[model samples]
Target: MLSTSLRVAILIGIIVYYFILIMLLRQKRLTLKYTLLWLFSGLMMLILSVFPQLLNGITRLLGIQLQSNALFAILFFCTMIILMSLTSIISKQNEAIKQLVQYTALLEKRVREIESCGD
Candidate 1:
């Protein structure tokens, strides 16, 4: 069982985490789409911290012997999801870069042809 002080600390940390996220969003440093996952995770942590019994019940249902192990499992799963999301974003950016390069090459070729014709 988590000590009362520990739970209170976790809640404070979650609040700070949320404040940072909101600040980033307002500054346009973080997009809403990307922040959604983070916001969700923070909310989950807040709930779990406020009601540790919910996690205990879930841990028992999952047949996890230790609550810490269950927490680790959840953290790992969230990490994997974030990794996959980042990968997808990278892939899309790569494709956009390729298209931009091709377009630039085409424009350069046209400019060279126009200059040669003028000469």
Candidate 2:
């Protein structure tokens, strides 16, 4: 069971997080696609904080012994999923960079050949 003050604190934290996220988005520091996951996480936390009973029910359903442990488990899972997503994005970007580098080299070689032929 969470104390009233603790729940209030969590709610406040979520609000602050959302505010910061929005500011970053507005400033173009964060992309919409990446921000979606963070926004979802914040919303979930806000909901859980507001309705502690829902969290308790979920923990019970999952057979988790403690609500805090359940919360940690959920957060860990979300972190793992986010990490995997980022890894995938990075892998794709790496391939694209490699392709761009190869194309640039080929273009440079063609340009040099043309210049030599002209001379």
Every model's TM-score? 0.88, 0.90
**lDDT tens per residue, model 1, 24-63:** 9999999998878888888877877787777788787988
For candidate 2, the 10 contiguous residues with the lowest summed lDDT are: 66-75
Give the per-residue lDDT of model 2 (tens digit) for 20-68.
9999999999999977878887788787777777778778898987776
Q: What residue pairs are clashing in model 1?
A: none
- Each model's total of backbone clashes: 0, 0
Q: Score residue 37 of candidate 2 by CA lDDT.
A: 79
Give the residue spans of candidate 2 off by over 4 A: none
Q: Give Cα distance to truth, residue 50, candidate 1, Å.
A: 0.8
What does each candidate score in C-alpha RMSD?
1.6, 1.4
